[model samples]
Target: MKKQNIVIGVAPTKRSFLSMEEAKRQKEKFMAVIRGIHPDVVTLVDIDDICENGILFETEKITQVVEKFRRAKIDALFTPHCDFGEEQCAAGVAAAMKVPTLVWGARDERPNTDESRGRDTQCGMFACTKVMRRFGVQYSYIWNCETESEDFRNGFDSFIRVVSVIKAVKNLRIAKFGARPEPFMSVTANEGDLATKLGVTVVPISPNTVAARMDQLIGENSPRLQDYVADVKQRMDASGMKEEAVERAAAAKLAIQDLMEEKHCAAGAMECWSAVTVLGAPVCMALGELSDEGLPVSCETDVNGAVTMAMLQAVTLGKEACFLADLTIRHPQNDNAELLWHCGPFPYSLKDSSSVARLVQGQERFELKKGPITVCRFDDVDGKYYLFGGEGKGVDGPETNGTYVWFETNNWKMWEEKLMFGPYIHHVGGIYGNYKKVLREAARYLGMIFDDADEQGVYSL
Candidate 1:
């Protein structure tokens, strides 16, 4: 995983009621905290000259700082108030940088009769925020005035998460194979709108092209195919599966891999059902393998689902894989739980080891790993994109063939209502963790409507 690059700026001013020595001390402390949080910090402007105002208040100085940040390709900016910060300078840097910005300050010292007593950074932060608003700059901030407090660390972490999502979305390119299956209009996406509004590009490839590639690989007796087959046999109970089915699935996986490499795509969505007619096996297991290997692939040509999966991958830095599943049926024993099942597209690593193993064709029958999971979807209504998600736990459930998980949310009825009445589909992406907060922050930064289903109720951002 690539580390997110961050640039730290300390805003100090001569007009601050505090002495130069106090400002320099606070600046060093802020730099220490920033250094502990991230490694790739860019000190765009020198803070050593405390005798002069350290803040870049002049337009020329702010422009020079912006140029430095742009050249370094920083992902986000952190502005800390050394003293009463230069509001104009902070806002100027934020507006010009055009990246996720965070503003914060140290707590004020108790006033004394001495001239060097007051820092008044809390007041400066407020003024800086107002100027940022006037300049139409969006930013995040630590509400607490203390720079070394736990609250500040948490807020800083959240800001990093937000930056990861923004960077991923801005640079994403989805490989779309074939089209949405017949009778599944819910998965249809406006590619033009996706590109124009969200900076997401879709590279279309035909199912026939993939099939042709698979046949060529088989004819050439590719070593990759042999390795993939060996891998499948090693990882799965393939005694029940047909030999031809196994070969076809492995060939399809290779073909998809080839196309992904050729197109330089980050994520993919495939026509799984249609490919079954051509490849002699469902592509679910192939997709699962790809997702497990760090590239998320969605079934039924779910473009938005692939995008959502990509977002999850970016936020988690591939530490977890997102499972693409349909909200199939309600759990028989648990009224508040629903069954999330797919043909066999869940990663093998997520399958329960104790479940009766059956690898028939490209489909594997097993229960998903039991733990906390988050269910989410990215969709649009009237050209406006939205992200919806909530937390749930993966619990023990009855097996009904294929990859399955019993997810119990706080309120199934409310979830159903949201899906039914909202611009969402039955297809959703699930990742193991409580990442609703991360997703919500990403949605806010991306300017997308976020519908969060929590215990209290559904709320929008």
Candidate 2:
């Protein structure tokens, strides 16, 4: 999530019969809007150098626009209807780009006072949608609206997130540090399907490898290791813990991270009990630290859970980190509340300010701060892969053990039924904002079914 590394291809489309000057002016406004909307978060490469007046219309110029975007290595394509667009040309460019795509146009002005025609941006956008389907081009859309309206901005932001998910999964590489714990059959995954369908790979790393690395990292006591130990000390009250325990935890963190980095992995899953056995301490604190730094790791070697965490992290464009938690229990007093807890593996940055952070048996113990949260999972059943997402909010409940929070969904019964009746499990990836809709949109591009817990209208092409 370099944020700025996600490049987008801009296609300003219009009808050649319309005023060329008007299309040019509109293209300028659209370009400015794209640049300003999410400044520094995304890079934009447009067709201005190839298309006449920087507007897409003539069929002959489609190849040039496609080649330019291809050469730029764009992650997504955005088509703005400058006027009644050349629908076929827009479709051609998107089909050629073969990336997550977005289409939209500014609301049209009323016809001239003299009864002359004005730019029918909405009409062109409507035509483009049909051709996009005709050309097998999948895309998201912002409805006919003013370019500066909040609606347009929200849609564009959502589209960018969709692009983020698509780009991330295309190059996703998760490190499977050890086999799944024997008891957790629910966390099993189809690695072959993950590779064939989503282009995701799981790099295997045996526990023996991690143990060797941990031993070497511990013996070093290098400046970097000492700095990490000091950093952890500042994050929590380590007064009751042994200095050796903290140092061991810090080394373990560095060890797993170094291994993942060596293998070029963005996510990881580990057999936690084995890790504890090898390091003489739980790696909960280390796991939390890694997730906080944007490298999500799930305990019990939950590969699918790690994948969910990675997707949820990317959905925020790396601006926010994600957490993987167990949907363990129901609040005794609150019917809709469910406890999301792990054995002190949550990031300290998400710790509740009102609560004191402490280390308990090498586990970081603190309650997570309250906020809107989106609980998501990527799972499969009988070869059918799907993404499950639901929105909730952190709420106060009876204090619990380890690092935890209570998430209250709109409908507790509905959520329970969805998870209970299907190919889902207790492990879920939680991120701080509501990106359920964006997850649904991203699923369309990834060839996964989108399952919404709360009943909502489907917005798909």
Candidate 2 residue runs with Cα over 4 Å from true position? 1-4, 112-114, 456-461
For candidate 1, lDDT tens digit of each residue in 53-85?
455434556666666667666677777777666
User: lDDT by residue for model 2 over 1-461, one digit each (tens)?
Assistant: 33425888888888888888888888887677778867667888877688787788899998888888888988998888988889888899998988888988988878646756689888778788998898888888888888778898899988988888877787889999778877789889999989998899999998778778877877776888899889889879988889998888888899889998899998999888755776677888888989877788988889889889889888989777788999899988889989999988998878889989998778888999999999999999999988888999999998877999999987787788877775789888899998999999999888898888896433323
Cand. 2 TM to true fold? 0.96
lDDT of 2 at 294: 78
| Clash-forming residue pairs, model 1 | none
- Residue 131, candidate 2: alpha-carbon lDDT: 86
Candidate 2 yields a Cα-based lDDT of 0.85
Best lDDT goes to which candidate?
Answer: 2
| TM-score for candidate 1, residues paired by index | 0.89
lDDT of each: 0.78, 0.85
C-alpha lDDT (0 to 100) for residue 225 of candidate 2:
89
